[model samples]
Target: MYVAVKGGERAIDNAHAWLAEERRGDKAVPELSVPQIREQMALAVNRVMAEGSLYDPDLAALAIKQARGDLIEAIFLIRAYRTTLPRFGGSNPIETETMTCDRRVSATFKDAPGGQVLGPTFDYTHRLLDFKLAADGDVDDAPLGTPHPDATPHIMSFLDQEDLIQSEPQGAETPADLTRTPLELPASRALRLQSLTRGDEGFILGMAYSTQRGYARNHAFVAELRIGAVAVEMDIPELGFAIEIGEITVTESETVNQFQGSKTQPPQFTRGYGLVFGMTERKAISMALVDRALRWKELGEDNVGAPAQDEEFVLYHSDNIQATGFLEHIKLPHYVDFQSELELIRKLRREAQENIMQEAAE
Candidate 1:
């Protein structure tokens, strides 16, 4: 039997007040604005929006402010707020093929179509802290080149033409929304993607690294990695047509893995796909690698019990909210359970002593 602990309402209220004061921190400093955070701390804003599954920069910025710069807490706040809004309907999937690419690169090919535009990336920067940036933090925007007007074709399509890569079939089926329903095993690619996009960045990175270290060695090559903006359109039932709603920046990564072929199938390379909100290349790439690893069963490849290959393991532990709540619950009072354990131990020790005394007397 267990007893519940109670009576902390007053303490809780006082603690919350103290927390709010600490969150503001030193009234002398100027308060941070949402727009400034949305603009200047763009990357952090992007992360919150990405994980929250919401596209509102203003709201994400506000969440960041309320969370006192804690990015994970900001994501949780955004996610909680998002649930209260009435969802009209699902939007049509944005066509990535028609993206206005700002950054595009290929690891397999030196000179890919669109001329390998490295619009903005930190790949070449020397890893040193700039004292000048710390002093004033003012830097001019880098010069831009004329973007290719045409929608850049995916690099994987070239291999697809030759039947040298696995093909993804177009379907009219509506995919499952993990947010609305409990997760079930043998998840579809759509559900898996949803889990990965909103998953903890560090966990996904670690899973991807495990594959590189030979846990499920797929020998992945970065087929293409792109960052760009795409228009979002939603259908109007009354009007009987879809119109452009808005645009959002995104990063997409495609990893080509080793060939999979048997007597029943042709020798063709398989692919892993990842698309994330905003310029999150590392997450996108990491997601792609983990995605491929998780598809071992679907691809008819043997599962050697790799952590990345376990769908239930990956999806179940991905959400930070669930993880945090369970971890924090250990701090709650467990006096009843502790007392039960203590009584059982005492009874077992007493029985042992009585048996020992009888044996000595004999």
Candidate 2:
């Protein structure tokens, strides 16, 4: 519990003022505009948008600037601001199959139907820092490639045709919105996905890595990983039809796990899916690994007691906003609680001394 320490209004005001000054840094350097952050620091903005559970890039950029490039703080700001906004009707599920992919690759297949398009990526880049970039040297524009004429179909669909992979039937039931409702234990796969997508990248990555390191090795193979823009649509009650609201860039990872056959069922490959906002391929891949590990029960696998498999543990601790809030609260005044503990300790020590003295007299 927090004790309200009174009479530091001036100090608080001064501290805030100083913080603003510090955020600006050297007066010689120009201030970072929101557009500059949105365009240049696109990855950071994407992370903020993804974790904040808000799609507004401009607002995310502004939050980043306000928080002085502290992503968690920016996410916190975005989340806080999101709570104040009016809720419109939810958008229809985006069709990733119809996505205009900027980058698409499949590890399972050397040559896929759409053909592999390796878009802007750091996969082949040398790890060494470029002095030219540091000096803000002008660079040549990236050469554009000819766009694919036809829409690329999912790689899993090919596996499905051969009956090689497990089928994922579309659920008729509307998923529970964790934002509107409190997160309950024994969450559905939909809720778990929601939590995972918005979870801390670092925490999720670590959990996913643990699975890879034999915590609960699922033998995941990236069936396909695609980064692209998909149109977001919402059904209009007045029009009785869905219309495109906007488009959002997203990274999708689909992993084919090892075959888990049962006595009653034939052997078939399982699936783990991850879809996140922006070009966050690393987080998307990590999310897929963790997602597969968590599906131990549904897949009729033994509970290995892995940390990732524990639904309650993963969901409860995944949210960085909630985690940081509880953690940072310790810095606030807890004078009464601390004083009570101090007094109890002193009283116990005094009683112990008196008891020793009595024993000596006897």
Best by TM-score: 2
TM-score, each model?
Answer: 0.93, 0.96
* Top-lDDT candidate index: 2
Error of 2 at 357 (Å): 3.4
Question: On residues 285-333, what C-alpha lDDT tens digit does candidate 1 reach at each position?
Answer: 9999999999887777888889999998898898776787788777777
Clash pairs (backbone) in predicted model 2:
none
Quantify all predictions' global Cα lDDT against the true fold: 0.88, 0.90
How much lDDT does candidate 1 score? Answer: 0.88
Off by over 4 Å in 1: 1-7, 144-148, 353-362
RMSD (CA, Å), each prediction: 2.1, 1.5
Error of 2 at 349 (Å): 1.4
